[model samples]
Target: MIHEDSPHRSATPGWLAVRLPVHALWLSLAVLAWFAIAAFAPRFGLLDWRAGLGFMVMTAGPLLLGLAVLVAALALALSLRSRPRGPWWKAALALAIPVIIGASLLQLRATAARVPPIHDVATDVVDPPQFSASTMALRDAAGANPLSPYNVPLGQLPAWQGRVEGAQAIQTHADLIGQHYGRLQPIPTGGRDPAQVYDAIVAAMADIGLRDIRRDPDAGIVEGVARTLAFGFRDDVVVRVRDGRIDLRSASRVGVSDLGYNAARLERLSRAIERRLATP
Candidate 1:
């Protein structure tokens, strides 16, 4: 026969009037603890923990603290039922409240300490082939000799381009290509046409059934997908054919588990290129 009025009247005054400043204190302490951990032992501490600490601090900490506060309020209400008797519930609640709040605050602080900030870049650069004249010429030349690799300068190859010798020469040549063929330093001192190079690469890729071909003639770069065996993968092939020498670089993503697959695919692609070139 508990009456609603009785329940409302039973709520203790001190319990009903929780000091908001106390909660603020807990929050402040939690924030400080997090920062302290981040400043010291940052690597091994919870502050460095990505998933667990972040989730608890960002979502679980507040929820658990709120629940503990509700429980304290309930205890206070029960204590008021024995008014004038000096409710023991009030003492019990007071003791439990601080302990629960402190624990939650500590955990939240640790989580906050571990959480890291994220950064992103913002720019307004237009899409690839920003210039098209070089690309057009590349496409035209590629139509005549798709496998020549002689249409552009060898020093202007893509960064991802490399030879499979597992040697350092590949990287050295790649840098040279960038310096000589990049839009920043066109061959023959301003004579390098990005649009022509882009067009040539696009035409070559098309000849090999590559899709999603994109060219940045302004930057003298091209990227696309090439199909090999039964699967399709992205390719970052840079071409520069200058000084009577042709430099071609083809790169595809590889994973530890797919080493065999990648090797086989590359072999097949090489054979296809050889056959295409021999045809003419």
Candidate 2:
């Protein structure tokens, strides 16, 4: 029997319409927690790095998006039903979480798309600076495959993304770094002495929390490895102090594209060096 003034005749789904704002509240918190797991679990050893990334991209991302839309639509519908507005602000806050996370991820992807899938960058191509014995030993212990951008068999260059992509993509990726970043100029030492410049390079590397620093003062070559905080992924680094120029090379220990991290790292190091020298 339908009443003329039926308050119960509203279209809000009981399942969708939960305790004023609690549904949105829980959903937002869940989305935020999922984001945290995706970001920090790999770093803290709480989750497998590969699995964490996969879950974030494949599962959590889509789930947040779909759930956010569903809840937002339901909330809007309920509010428009001429019934009392239950804590709508909670729904807004809940929706904001997934929206924020999704927007950030999209920006990251857009930046990545603009970058080439090359992991190595150097001042010169003819003879890129070589790493020291310490780095080689560490890589060996870590089971890091051949560390050069050359045509090696699959599983050899684990740091590169193409290794997983297939064997044929190996040389194709190697050619990318050489073709793109070749002729990338070395930083000039402002005519400073090589000894002084080497110290500065060491200081700069230290500022960036580099590992396994190897110094060859006589040869004017300094080598070290940088690691990403989240996954401890390694990037080999070498600095050469010439008469008036300082050459630099940075190559990811794995992955075909470093997401433009290597180039950005070099810029940060360059700025750090300038700051160090600027200090009286």
Task: State which candidate has the highest lDDT.
Answer: 2
Error of 2 at 61 (Å): 3.4
lDDT of 1 by residue, 167-235 (tens): 322333223323322322212212334444444445656666667677554443454544333122233
Q: Say what the RMSD of model 2 is.
A: 4.3
Candidate 2's C-alpha runs over 4 A off are 1-20, 79-82, 150-184, 209-212, 278-280
Residues 24-83 of candidate 2 have per-residue lDDT tens digits of 668778777877777677777788666777777556677777787577656645644535
lDDT (Cα) of model 1: 0.38
Instruction: Give the winner by TM-score.
Output: 2
lDDT of 1 at 208: 67
